[model samples]
Target: MKSLIVNADDLGRSAGIDAGIARAHREGIVTSATLMTNGPGAEGGGAVARENPDLGVGVHLVLTYGRPLSDPATVPSLVEPDGGFPVKASAVIGRGRVRTDEVLREYRAQLERARELIGREPTHVDTHHWVQEEPGVFTAFLELARESGLAARPLNDAERERLRAAGVRTPDRYVREFQHPRAIDVAALLALLELIAAAGDGATELMCHPGEPDPELERTSAYAVARPVELATLTDPAVRAKVRELGFQPITYGDL
Candidate 1:
């Protein structure tokens, strides 16, 4: 029994990204998405989610980039003076500048913002740049999940075990592309499917960033051009056929 979740991250970052996520869910093997409440296209992302109820939208709680959903004055330890979040994960978690209390408040704010924008609770919660994987931050985030009764995206065996022990929901297996531009590698994905099928017994997730190329995305991320290629790979019929051939069921976090 192998289930695969092709969950795209950075929804609401820009118009291009929003469109790409929507298309991937509608036309490709993508089953879910993690929406960024503080992103530039947040309102658009919420509207898109409402339009496509099957997408299984979740909150992409961010603390490492862009602006903060909580007032900057209120979360001073978490944001820069200018109100933007630090681009480096270390500045917040590693430096210990962001206190546990700040994380609790900001994370709840982001979750609430997501609910307000999406018009419903998210199916799950994950972080921008895997920020929740950091030491003190991870503990705080786990607590939030427990309190909210929301599933979380745990990337490794240890984290999975920790979450499960805490009575939280998560996938059984996690797949990440070691190569840069992970989402565009259809051949690699096909091979991965073969590998997972051979192993045979866990729910897994494949995280991706697929989007249309746009000036805003280019300015904000180094990942701009790779997005369109990723979009192409995800929407490719051959890739979907291969997924079916391998007998991997495409699912959302809701299905976990």
Candidate 2:
């Protein structure tokens, strides 16, 4: 009845990031990861994952701040004219500039990129930047994975039927919106507990990013020093004990 999956996102973003995920999975609470198709150190991450088949690798469908799987010029609707996905999704959604058709095409390309590189359709699907959660992009993104007959995000018992109909896997929870710092107050942890509890019967994809609190990641991501905090949380004996106290057995996408 109590199951959880501690997942690391942005696996190929950097050596530092990838190494942190590897270590978290190897020695901490990390149970799965979503790979960035256009990420740096992608090849290295793939090699490591290949060697460690135990790691649950899924596609972190990217739609912003990175290279597109399709030519940017061709997939203009998916990115800015300059080839980057929009920096602010709200502005794009507000302006109605998001070309859903182009996005669909580009997402398909992202899927193919995952297959070509990782040697198979991803075991599961998650979006980079949580872009799939965006309004126009959400259902269409799910359709793309459904078309490929791959497992999609499963959130409930009724949805479990949906996934079963599509021959996909189903889980109850996902960790979206992870921008907060690790030095969270009681309110933050309480909020997280609330979110996790909302996912009634299925598994939860507990998303996190764990890395060193150093200039290397700081210069590149807003999550710089925060990575160490995440690592700390994963390695935190107290937090692990809490999972046990809450009765959530950790799991991954491959567990289905």
Candidate 3:
């Protein structure tokens, strides 16, 4: 039997985003969420998570365009002079402009802040824009997660071997299916399900960005109206019937 962990990212991005995430967890089939500590609706999301302890909460580590919780001076090397993390993290990853030690410090601070604000550290850490996959960045993230008692993104064969050597937990599931605004389609939804079915029978996590049908989402947030597909995937009797037919269990991050 296969166990699935479904997660919604960017939970604290906005009220619309927060409400959407909550509603999905309540009625629409979302099981877990990645909290954005510095997001606008962070406090509210944190409150909701506390209220609904069943909803698995994890850290959506941010290194992109958003205000940092820590003071710029406090995390000098992590943010731009304008006091925002880089919106385009890929551009500056190999530019030799950032100090790795300072980056690690800021990450630690962020982890601590998340624990303080949410009242607990995350069970897992996922990068924003997969920026942590960059050189040096992954090591920093791994080290922090190890220190904070959180898990990290899994790696390739050699790296996986190293993780085993270090006694780190490798993710059993991969969220290969994500709801990008541009990639929204019924076919994609079916493909996502197919991928989930194809993943080896073990703990698997499917991450998504499902939100309300709001034009403002496109204007303000990186999320699009993939809620239709996501909602459909959950509420559709056919999909629900399929879950039963396949005899799969939907778990959350905390369930891990």
In terms of lDDT, which candidate is strongest? 1
Model 1 agreement with the true structure over 116-207: per-residue lDDT tens digits: 98887788988888887677678878888888888889978898899889989999887767235453577776777688778787788888
Candidate 1 ranges with C-alpha deviation above 4 Å: 178-183
lDDT pick, better of 1 and 3: 1
Colliding pairs, model 2: 4-251, 172-203
Per-prediction TM-score to the true structure, in the order listed: 0.95, 0.82, 0.86
User: Cα-based RMSD of the predictions, in order?
Assistant: 1.6, 3.5, 2.6
Model 2: weakest 10-residue lDDT segment is 181-190
Q: After superposition, how far is residue 163 of candidate 1 from its true place, in Å?
A: 0.9
Candidate 2 TM-score, C-alpha based: 0.82
- Residue 103's lDDT within candidate 1 is 85
Candidates' lDDT values, in order? 0.84, 0.69, 0.68
Q: Residue 69 in model 2: shift from native, Å?
A: 1.6
Q: Write the per-residue lDDT of candidate 3 for residues 161-180, one digit (tens) a residue.
A: 55546666555756644565
How do these models rank on TM-score, best leading? Answer: 1, 3, 2
Candidate 2 lDDT over 1-256, as tens digits, reads: 8677777888777777777788777777678887887756677667656755677788777777577878888877777667777655464444555677777887788777767666654777776665654556766666776777666664345555655676666566556444464443334544675568666666777778777555766876787677766776676666656666777777777776
Error of 2 at 72 (Å): 1.7
